[model samples]
Target: MGSTGDSGNGKAGWWCRRSSSPSSSSTASSSTPSRTFETRDPRTGDVLAHIAEADKADVDIAVKAAREAFEHGKWPRMSGYERSRVMNKLADLVEQHADELAALDGADAGKLLTLGKIIDMPAAAQMLRYYAGAADKIHGESLRVAGKYQGYTLKEPIGVVGVIIPWNFPTMMFFLKVSPALAAGCTVVVKPAEQTPLSALYYAHLAKLAGVPDGVINVVPGFGPTAGAALSSHMDVDSIAFTGSAEIGRTIMESAARSNLKNVSLELGGKSPMIVFDDADVDMAVSLSTLAVFFNKGEICVAGSRVYVQEGIYDEFVKKAVEAAKNWKVGDPFDAATNMGPQVDKVQFERVLKYIEIGKNEGATLLTGGKPTGDKGYYIEPTIFVDVKEDMTIAQEEIFGPVMSLMKFKTVEEAIEKANCTKYGLAAGIVTKNLNIANMVSRSVRAGTVWVNCYFAFDPDAPFGGFKMSGFGRDQGMVAIDKYLQVKSVITAVPDSPWY
Candidate 1:
């Protein structure tokens, strides 16, 4: 395979190459790529790298390599303890190259370089090490059954997984999906979002250096309609792990069913709510709520975009929120003090601006910061809207941007009712002094993960996913490894068994 070596462009070449057979390897199609796409720096719209666009043929090659790896390579056949050592080594490599990886994500996806260094990079390493610790712990149960047969269950890797990650947190999502699948002894064909493929290709290189077999981890950088659709629908891919929009999640599910009925786990979209009760501290509520929506320019799936505040504090919260939005800095991602970065690309930038206009047309009062910043790049100011009705477009839809919608409710019942009104239920946040109110609302709300008095409190041990239109299956816990595994029941008759 044409691994991560520099071509004439001074950028890394395609991680996976087009091959005549599973074992054979060659460069891309010709001296030049049949199709090429430019990955840009979201802060300046400067060309970061010219990526070779992978098509169906390229996808086929990657899938075949992964299939061969799972079937014949040493990865799947290795003992859990042996696999754990390699995974731990990979984790060490991630930590060593944290700064470089963080820089790549900042330029490619417009992630805050500080956040990329402190939170995103470290978090990726933590997840990898967490799953590495879990690799040696994957075991099945010995069952007691009727009759003279001895029965037990064997937990085995579900071969050849296809991992399609979003662009928002490329490094984090890469480890989020790839780490557990690798720990579970399954080879993977990862299709990183087109906007941010640099770090993923680098990670593929790191995996090889960490002693993962060549075919064990393959990355194909291309658009979704071509590379993504092919990976989702490939017959040799036994399972698919995807993190993206609900609409595309549905399409992947349908393709999985129509093709080979492969196991699919999707972590999709969210129109999450942050509920603030009357007794809550206004400063704390304002701070956490802003962090929820404005972090990562609101590209996060679990962003608390729709905020429900009690009537008593609605006026005060909205007042402080406006000041906060106005003061929130939007600038170059590499700046140490920049609070938020630009949208991943022009498409998301336009989508968010269009939604802000829709919110205005629908009668929601735009309080402050609805405009874009800078003469270049896809930068948008932190926006706040008050008097947002539950039925309005901004409140109902997942406008993934630095936009917040504030609505007021009178009572706990009303808060829960209005919060649950949305079709997506990925995550929610509750801010209250009263523990009883927090418990009541947390139990009443239909979200997969609820944070009380905090927001974006993600941990490797805690499982995260969605309910309803937000999509299904959990990620980021011990349960995550199960998504890449299959349970086989083994039953054998004893020497004196009646059946025998």
Candidate 2:
């Protein structure tokens, strides 16, 4: 099992080894019999591997390592071009081990191997490369002032970042937070979600191989409340970057305020709307709408959970959508033809099932697929509901599953009204040939991203995040650098002071 080369321990397979050499205290703590977790394949419910669950003590070790690397090591003080070289190397390695990494992702998260191998992993490496190019461009601004004193702003690294990643897209979220932090010269202690910790640890090994200094990127595989909370509230951490739910984002913000007042950036959950007008391309809408929700079994944060159709076209749209949903092949994730896969774990499986019941109890008419599929893995049918009122629980909540609640609207105004009613503002979509309607609704809707005539269109150049309860701060693009960097204004007198 020992060969994904350049890993510190050379112990590969499903097992991920710790990167840094532990202190004597850490060594003692490692042997104290902490709680552990077994990662199982969501498709088969078979044990994939086991990881040591970290607590507050383990978080302290990782945070201290990151602090030391940021404060005293050569990484933060290195030239931008030099850091860029390491980042670029990381991107290259991601491509090199794409298959192995993709398989690990499939086994750990029940992601379809085809999707992971083809889309998710490649996109992650591309995102890293995008951030790598920005490394050399991180510089202070020159001053042009009227006074005798010269003033300019310095863009410097915010030391010791704490990154908490979500399980939905493990590889992407890891680079989404870690890439820019590394580009900005900040060291990071990452606590990946308990459900999918293997890939994050594996990424740490790849970073080490790519020439990132040992302490610059540390991985502590653990749960949110213990390791995550400790990192958020630790006095040494200069900032915390998180991607998860709105409720958890609040706890992180409060922890930041009460601790060292660390900077906090969040990308939270969503109940994004996908609106279809009477004159739109119904076939195109049917296709993209299916991809939007059922692409990852609706595990995405921006999944189009609330779909609104003009009343004239509501009946027709529902018919085509259900017909398209029937073709989404759900089975073993490793199969090349499988487009849909199992939910990540038992909790999420139960949660999505509970919401299906809520839709029934709340009076939404179930059009098709309101039941679980097989008896083995946590697989559920790609469900759809029609005649859903905006006030229904299924229509309002962030049901992160392969479920779509179809609602009818009389006008564009009505569509916009019902779309923005949710507490979430992560993303929304518009499908119509009318440019006027597209521009009007795009400007009016309260979302971080609006897809016109399309759904789930994303680029590294575009800054992505949400408004209101969905959370603050942007990820990807140039704006992401602002989160990891602090601006310092320096002023120096060119002449003698007036007092003198």
Best by TM-score: 1
Model 1: lDDT to the true structure: 0.88
Per-prediction TM-score, please?
0.94, 0.93
What are the lDDT figures for the candidates, one per model? Answer: 0.88, 0.84
- Mark the regions of model 1 whose C-alpha exceeds 4 Å error after superposition: 1-33, 495-500
Q: How far out, in Å, is residue 207 in model 2? A: 0.8
Cα lDDT tens digits for candidate 1, 152-266: 9999999999999999999999999999999999998888999998899889778868888767887888888988999999999999999999999999999999999999999
Write model 2 residue lDDT over 1-500, tens digit each, in one string. Answer: 11122233211112333332233121222222256777777887877666777778767767666776777888999888899999889999998998989888888898988878778888999998898899989878888766677878999999989999899999999999998999999998888888888788778768878888757887777778888899899999999999999899999999999998999999999999999999988999999899888888899999998989898888899999999888777888899988888999989999999999999998998877878888799898899998788888998889899999988899889889998999999999999999999999999999999999887778889999999898999998999999999999998887864532
TM-score of 1: 0.94
Highest lDDT against the true fold, candidate: 1
lDDT at 333, model 1: 89
